[model samples]
Target chain A: MRDLLRILSRFWRASLAAELEYRVNFVFSTLNAALGLVLGLFALSLFFQNGHAFDGWSFDASLVVYGLFTTFSGISSVLFVPNLSRVVEHVDKGTMDFVLLKPVDSQLFVSTRNFSPWGLPDIALGLGVIGYAARRLDVDPGHVPAALLAALLSLIILYSLWFALASTSIWFVKVYNATEVLRGLLDAGRLPIAAYPAGYRVFFTYVVPVAFLTSVPADVLRGADATSWLAIEVVVAVLAFGLSRAFWRLSLRSYTSASS
Target chain B: MTFLRRARAFLEVYYAYMLVYRSELLLWALAMSLPFISMGAWIKAADTGAFPLAPVEFGRYFLVVYLVRQLTVVWVVWEFEYDIVQGRLSPRLLQPADPVWHYVGGHVAERAARLPFTVVIVAFFFMLYPEAWFVPSWTETVACLALSLLAWVLRFVLQYAFAMAAFWTEKASSIEGLWQIGFLFLSGVVAPLAVFPEAVREVVLYTPFPYLIDVPVRALLGAPITLRDVLIPGAWLLVALVAQRLAWRAGLARYSSMGA
Candidate 1:
């Protein structure tokens, strides 16, 4: 564990130093994220026009969901996208041989290899929005930890799904767009599950599992009695993580490297 | 080579190349599924409350939005930057014809490949929710298709202009990211322009963004539209064409190959 931590820090620092060489990207990403937040707010406001709402979700409540989605988008760019995209490149180039040759677990190394600080602005903005929404809702301080726990579970579910998609590259070598489709579908989480129609509610909840990623966490954040939902989120996260692990192992078994 | 012959060769070769990536293209088509998800929310809102567009109309509108989005999508900035950064632009530059035509050919061919996938998804979606289906007059269909093509051209030229930044910076694609935020929100990708506040919609219509997605969607859905809808985007296209021309000349003047 300590060795992994050292390795993680080392990789992050190296990438950070290299990325700093192009400081202009930081400015561009900040601007991009800020503009994106404005657009999201505008879209949310459209749903609330004339005292209407997304199903029963007030604008403020949905903002919490949007905030979580933004926060996770930043986390995705920082962790999931950078690493998982490299997974495809490495597999395509028959470079997975080198990854397996390393002393550490290949999955760990592939999953935690690089960090992009560009998502920092998005992360900060998301937290700011979340705080603002929570204040508006007058959320109880005691339930904040419950929200955090649900969000942590949400992260686990999200990472597992992304990793599983990336791992398919070992067999298909071009599943990059599969992950793109996943990210696109996950955009549904920007609103509460209840906002969608019955069929779509089932599709997102079971097929894509988007509900646990944002809506459930938002519900918890606003102090809704959502313990049952949180429990379901816990189970879903665990199953997703385990399934991803098994899938990666199976995929690796089929991976025939050109290098060796 | 003559102009007609050169265009023929580009399209044929690139079409074959795109056909080879058929499955990849399918995944890319699926990556734009956000409209379907949003359609569910809009339909729900229309069902549960008073809204500008009816429930069936919201369904029809968002489906058309998805179709227009697929038809008008552009990724020239990323491809152009790659050519510049990797110095692959040299051989194309050495050719008698301009290199921009190469990227344009690829985009057109990719769009051709995407058409079948788009049709399949639309067919399947209508199968599941037949209530969203609508039939429009031939004139409206033709006009919508024309505007969709025009939107594609305008977006391509604008992005190609931004792609010129690769001459000075390695991260030209970041500009695409920023541009997409505006494209997603202002272009009515999130919801129909009818749902937007009248004043905001009026202001947004003045911009090129809504002309790209909303205008075509409205036209296809048999909503009231004037020649002004077509005129605004046509004017923007001319402006973008000039900008693209200036940027290409400047970028070519400053261009240096990777190992040069």
Candidate 2:
């Protein structure tokens, strides 16, 4: 626990320093994120304009899904996008040698080191949407703490899924393009799972876990109370993380530096 | 050798590169089918007779959106940003043909090679929804195709100009993200601009982004096409072309190649 905290502190400090170097970009990103937040909310309004229920979910219910999507996606942008790009860099430069020399887990370090400090703007905006939606839905403040917890757990599952995909760069250098593939799947989060057909809902919820990132938490927020879903999320996350670790280790064993 | 001869030689070589990566090309084309997936969900919901657009109408709208997305999607921003930053642009500049034109040729060539796959996918989707074909009148089809091509060029030039910002700033990645968020909302990738509130839709149409996706898509689907419709999107494309020219001229002068 202490070691993990130390690493996280160091990572945060590095990100802060890097972000501080480009203050104007940070401000622009914040404004950009806020604009996206407004657009997301407005989109919901437009959908509700036509009628009330969309795929059996109320406007407020779908709003929770959108809110959770922004929150988890913010977590992803903050953690994964920055780090996943480095996988491509490492592959291009044959820099796996440096990673292998580390005493600690190379995959962990690589996956965690590319933190961007400015992504919190999206997180804050997501909270504002969720709060507004909660008011509109008449959700109890007592449920807020549970929603936050679910969001964190959901974020964990999301991070693991991304890391597993990024680790594929060890064997398939071209897999960097897969990040966009992942983003395409994540885009499904914009709507609630209840809005999709049965096959799609099943595919997203279990097969890919795309729905878990937002829909499940939103369902809980709407009083569906699927806490068992969180347990499944934690299990999937751990399994995914382990698979990535194994892959990284096996690839390192065959690393044979890209000297050519 | 003559300029046309050299151009032919370059085209031949570029074609070979694309053939080698044909699988990746197919995947890239398939990746653009997110709109189709969304269409499925919406159509299924509309099938229940509860939503605004009927299943057939929803199919027509989303199919158009899918095609427009393919026409307007630009990965060149990242490609150009890398070339400029890594000094690859310097070597290209030494070539007889203008580097930008050469880059555009290569980009177009890749798209041309993939055209068959794109057509097949579109045909397959259309077959899957024969009732929702929205078969355009021949004149409307020709006009829509023309505007779609213009939208394609507008998107490419705008993104290429945005990518050239590497000459002035180190945070091109963040800038790209900002651009994407803007494109997502303004280009109607998240939802149709028609779905947006009236005031918001009015303001967004004044910008060039919508021409890149929404206008061409709506036009192709046989949605309210008029001389005024053509004029508005045409004006935006013209303005983009002018801005692109200015930005490219300025950016080329300031470009410090990677060797330095």
DockQ of 2: 0.45
For model 1 chain B, give the 10-residue run with minimal summed lDDT.
Answer: B251-260
Window of ten residues with lowest summed lDDT in model 2 chain A: A43-52
| Per-residue lDDT value at A140 in model 1 | 92
Best by DockQ: 1
Candidate 1 ranges beyond 4 A from true positions: B258-260
Residues A31-121, candidate 1: write the lDDT tens digits: 9999999989988887776677876578889999999999999999989999999999999998889999999888899999888899999
lDDT of 2 by residue, B166-238 (tens): 7788656666677777777678665677556778878887777677777777777666666766677677667
Worst 10 residues of 2 chain B by lDDT: B44-53
lDDT, candidate 1, equals 0.89
TM-score of chain A of 2: 0.89
With a 3 Å backbone cut-off (N, CA, C), the pairs that clash in candidate 1 are none
